[model samples]
Target: MKRREAREKAVQTLFQLDRTEMSIDEAITYIIESPIDPFYERLVKGTVNHKEEIDKTLEDKLEHWSLERLPKIERTVLRLAVYELLFEDEIPHSVVLNEAVELCKRFGDEKSGRFVNGVLSKFEQK
Candidate 1:
């Protein structure tokens, strides 16, 4: 799968992990195909591995909203995007930001895209 599909898969996988009791492997397997894209694997696993740091960073960026107060899918998207911004140096920051907004749009409420965009823009400015 391409990066876009991989990103979508990563978002769903991460969301499943956050909202359910599924293990990382189970979450990935449930969300992705047998030959999982390498990028997708890295996104899910890396995000999980670095979740504490990611959440902390997001907490600092959030204006009025606490990380846990965010909707599940939006919180998942933010975590995944923060992973890319902090770890996946190979991917452009703009791509990470854009893909995150897209994910929120696809899986979250109408305001999700704007919320994600606003949070991600803080990373870009720094």
Candidate 2:
């Protein structure tokens, strides 16, 4: 799968895991139709594995908004982007940030892209 496709799937799977309390294995299977792609597996597992740290980082960076107070789509997109930013060293920071903004634009509300870009820029600066 293309990385963009993997990212979208990752966000969907993560959203499922968050909202339904589904197991990682179940979430992956539910979202991905083909045999498991390695990139997809890594994103979903990595995000799940590091969610606490990611959430803490996001909590600290968000202006006045708590992570929990964000909409579910925005929260899930941020979690996936943050996972890529912190864990996926093979991908450039700029690429990750750009992809995240694209994903937000596609999956979230009109302001999501800007909101995602602003939050991720803080990570890029760090």
Candidate 3:
């Protein structure tokens, strides 16, 4: 699968894992029907594996809202993007940020994209 597709699925899978008790494997299977794509799995697994660090990074970036207070979609998108930004050096920062905004626009509310960009731009600037 393409990186874009994998990112969208990773956001969805991460969203599922966030909202439920589902394991990573269960979340992956629920979202992706075909053989597991490495990129998608990496996004989900890497995010889960380093969630505490990701959340801490997010916690520091959030203005007034706490990480838990953010919408689930936004929270998951941030986690996935942060995972890429922090660990996946193969992808450019701009691509990760742009894809994150697109994911928010596609799966989240009208303001989700703007919110994601605002938070992630801080990381980009650092």
Q: Largest lDDT belongs to which candidate?
A: 3
Which digits, one per residue and each the tens of the lDDT, describe model 2 over residues 19-65?
67689999899988768999999999999999999999999889989
**Model 2 stretches with alpha carbons more than 4 Å out:** none
lDDT of 1 at 88: 85
Clashing pairs in 1: none
Candidate 2's clash total is 0
Per-model TM-score, in order, reads 0.94, 0.94, 0.95
lDDT computed for candidate 2: 0.89
RMSD of 2: 1.3
lDDT of each residue in 56-92, candidate 3, tens digit only: 9989999999987998999999999999999998888
CA-lDDT, candidates in order: 0.89, 0.89, 0.90
lDDT of 1: 0.89
lDDT of 1 by residue, 7-124 (tens): 9999889988995788999998888768878899999999999999999999999999998899898899999999999998888888888898889878887699999989999996
